[model samples]
Target: MKIVEERISQHFQLYTNFSMNSPIRLYVRFVFVHDGMNGIISSDKRRRVVNALAKAFSSRFVFNHIDLNDQGLYCPDYFRLLKDSEEERYIKAKTQRDPNVYLHIYSADTFDGAKYRNWSSFPWGLEDDPVMDGVVVDYRNIENEESYHWIIHEVGHWFGLVHTFENGCNPPGDYVDDTEAHSDEIRGCPPEGIHNACPEEKRAPINNYMNYTDCKDTFTLGQIERIFRVAKVYRPKLLEPEVCIPPCPPPM
Candidate 1:
């Protein structure tokens, strides 16, 4: 808690001006709060799933592997509170303060809201509560091979990405150029009737990671550009090498 209070002093120091191909690194702290053994997954196994998306980031930016920390924990009651309110995120961030940690991922057996696979604090979403400004993910989502991009999609939100149909498709859908604006979210990757709302284009980018379409397998150049842009400014730590090595992702 004291460290969280101390962190605010450096909150204004934005890490920026990185090259497009610089070898950048970001640390993800996975605070595992036990609901039961069902919530836990082996680090090696989790790393395998997470790295698949990390590899995707490398293709666009000089991004390095995410440093993973599984040692942080939350009591059962407090873990449940995570879903009860948005401010709870600020509380958890204070509880799990680590000087070198960059991104925080709260893993529970199941998220309080079962609708989406995972949810995260948007870029500066936790600005008011800087310490807890991270992502919460249900392990089940990332574990599913059919939905491996779950973490990526959430992180994309942290990087200032919005849903493809954000604001119901009138304009600026997802705010990315390469992605088309759909009138509504296309779920389950339906092959037919997936089109943009504004009419400049015919089909939505269902495969785009930002969309909730069942099989999200790609990120357009626009999304990649947007992600790195935010990473450079708002989330500068993600663009720099981690100062302390909590632990590296298991060798791929």
Candidate 2:
């Protein structure tokens, strides 16, 4: 991952010009890779994944396109792409130049051969590698209902959200004020009642989408505000009126 040397304070300057109440319609383009090793994902499964995303995003997501590429191009070495630059080349060649469409790639192979489920590029946060612009999910991670939150978690990162436990209980942790500070992620469903670990003694954000817990569900107000701010600054094209078509009016 490329290291971004930017500070959170510098990135999220106070700005009231952009309205926060309006819904944001995010356009997404999915590319499924069939490398013969894992076979192609069924259309039903694909729809289910998209539905899950829509539910997670509160119906603010739009599916622009779904395409299957049977080039058998797999990134076996993961990060070492020189030997397997075909996959990179394919992505670069296939990626649409339109900034409104966010590209998501689904493949069967693990990113690091083990313990790696998914990867996403933060717009202007921690990792902002220009080459790695979208989100990539391993097929194994999306096989069950329990793992559906993984997509939401990665998407949160793509929208400039760091982990809930990002700065280890320090100031500017995850750059969100509402979410409590924690030293590390709380994996799986945390037990009922207050679960505080950091020095602040506040309850950990076990249910936040940016957290690693299994019961992930909501994004804090701060996170939502930050997402809009980040989009306004780093991804201005996404907010264009032309990018999202207005809904049809009801009968008069």
Candidate 3:
């Protein structure tokens, strides 16, 4: 993650004036890995989950398709931290079937022994291995209302946004000037009040989607700009309209 952050920062520095004339429509697909025990998520749940994601990103993402893989593609541990052999097999089996898919998310019944509930590959980090591009989250994250933010947070990273507490409140933190720097991530939800943590005593960005707080719901103006710039620079394929399938939904 640190390596990816550095690459993103450097790229942003090089393309500081990058801008997009129009918003890009994202085609997304969902794959449910059957755990052979808990079964796959229901259609109603899938719609609600897609709705939540659409709401979060202002409807830039389109619901493409849902796939149920009973071929044992489950990620028992952290998806990104899987052993080389396991990772290769998982990526090969979960490979994107639709050429129009800009992003693919996989959900499993358990990431039981993993330290984190979800993982996503940064676009800039996929230069060496593009097949591993995707997001993985525990199935409970989609089912439980309280953990819904986890999906948004991981997607933020996929869009090139980093943690608010990145680099420990130092210069170039998160590479977004509008986001206030913090020494570390604020765990759980805290009371509604001013939370200052940087040396300059600026208010912490507890409400930013890239932050670890449970109440995170919005992205700063600078973060939004950076997201577009990153897409244009590192993931230009996402900006090409020809790559997306027909009937792209209008923004919500």
Please, what is the TM-score per model? Answer: 0.76, 0.76, 0.79
lDDT of each: 0.61, 0.62, 0.68
Which candidate wins on TM-score?
3
Candidate 3 matches the true fold with a TM-score of 0.79
Model 1 agreement with the true structure over 118-206: per-residue lDDT tens digits:
77776644446565566677767555666567777887786678888886656544656777777777778666444654567777777
Estimate the TM-score for candidate 1.
0.76
- The candidate scoring highest on lDDT is 3
Candidate 2 displacement at residue 176 in angstroms: 0.8
lDDT of 3 by residue, 58-175 (tens): 6444444443433434544434333233653465455665422467777765464756668887877656666667777777787787788888899888888889888876777788
Worst lDDT run of 10 residues, candidate 2, spans 75-84
Position 56, candidate 2: lDDT: 73
Q: Candidates sorted by TM-score, descending order?
A: 3, 2, 1
Candidate 1 structure lDDT: 0.61
- Candidate 2 lDDT over 110-194, as tens digits, reads 4565555677767763223455566777665556667879987888888788888887867767777788788887887977435
RMSD of each: 6.6, 5.2, 4.3
